[model samples]
Target: MTYQEKKSIVSLISAILIFGSFCLYMYPQYPEGGLGSAETFRYWGSFVLILTVVSIVAHIIISIIFNIVFRMTTKEKEPKFMDELDKLIDLKANRNSFFVFIIGFLLAMSSLIIYQPSQMMFIILIASGFISDVMGSVTKLYHYRRGV
Candidate 1:
């Protein structure tokens, strides 16, 4: 695999792991009274801070491990720079991911209009951001695999 492809794969994996971890960590702690409650806000604040730190640490560790494995297993040297095709693929992937993010944002806005819950809106927005990131990485990997 090319360096860009490997990077995309690592990113996609990291996004999935982080999203899953956040869901698992937050699921049981969901406030019964809803997000508007002061207690719920406090919990969410702490959760966001903790999750951010954990996700950063986890991704860094995973990237380091993958780099080591790739170096050990691969005979060919890694490319030192991205060429035009890699840049094009990245641009296209980002464009597609932007569309995904816009859709997610619209959905979040609609939820706010219909449900009028600040807590749910916040959750949806956060989820949309993560989903967009994952979508971008996945798109990049797809383009790489397809030789686009």
Candidate 2:
């Protein structure tokens, strides 16, 4: 497969891992309220948040490394852009990311306004919104045959 195809596959896998994290988190809460005490909540919440952040940051760093490795292995200069398809491919990732972020931001604010979700939920929502923005770009790239 091409580098772009490989990159998008890895990103999709990362998104799935994140979605898995969300699932693991929700499983405990399914029976009813999440635990009894505030202290218990704090510990678990912090644990999950730290783990999620670390996982995502690690994914990004590793992805950058993978791209570098692939480039080095291929020993070819990266593709240059002078044509219409190149320009479109170059801009599509950023354009879609920005659009998703703006929309997610608006949605998050409206969600907070109407539902008044807890502080933790607000934080998670914000994090997930950003994740969704990135996923949007990755998904677009997959369809458009662009690399990260």
Candidate 3:
């Protein structure tokens, strides 16, 4: 498989694993207060902020490791530049990812309109963010494999 395809697959798997493990680690730490309590909000707020930072750092580390492994195994240098097709594929992936996140955002809002707990809104938002990351990776993989 090509480098882009391999990278995309690694990204997809890493996103899933990082999110899953992070959620598992955080689950038991959830505040035991009432759902709408200040402590509960603080917990969810920290959850989202920390997840963002963790995901960014993990993806960067994984990308660097992937490049090093690819060089050692295949003896091929990573592409030095993004060509037109690469740019286009990336743009499409971003657009799709943004679209998914916006939908999630709206749904999260609607949860409030429907009188769901604030925790439910946070949950929807978090899940959407994770799904968007996965969607972007999948879009890149698909375009690379299927000719745009």
Candidate of highest TM-score: 3
For residues 36-148, write the lDDT of model 2, one tens digit per residue: 55755665576557666866796888687777877899886444434565456547766776666666667667776777545444455556555764665476566566343
Q: Which candidate leads in lDDT?
A: 3
Judged by whole-model lDDT over C-alpha atoms, candidate 2 comes out at 0.62
Global lDDT of each candidate: 0.81, 0.62, 0.97
- Model 3 root-mean-square deviation: 0.7
> Model 3, range 1-148, lDDT digits (tens) per residue?
9999999999999999999999999999988888879999999999999999999999999999999999999999999999999999999999999999999999999999999999999999999999999999999999999978
Query: Mind giving the per-residue lDDT tens digits that candidate 1 earns over 15-61?
Result: 89887978897889877875578888887777767777887888889
Give the lowest summed-lDDT range of ten residues in model 2.
29-38
Query: On lDDT, who's better, 1 or 2?
Result: 1
**Root-mean-square deviation of every model:** 2.3, 5.3, 0.7
The lDDT of model 1 is: 0.81
TM-score for each model: 0.81, 0.55, 0.98
Candidates 1 and 3 compared: the better one by TM-score is: 3
Q: Candidate 2 regions off by >4 Å? A: 22-52, 64-90, 119-134, 146-148
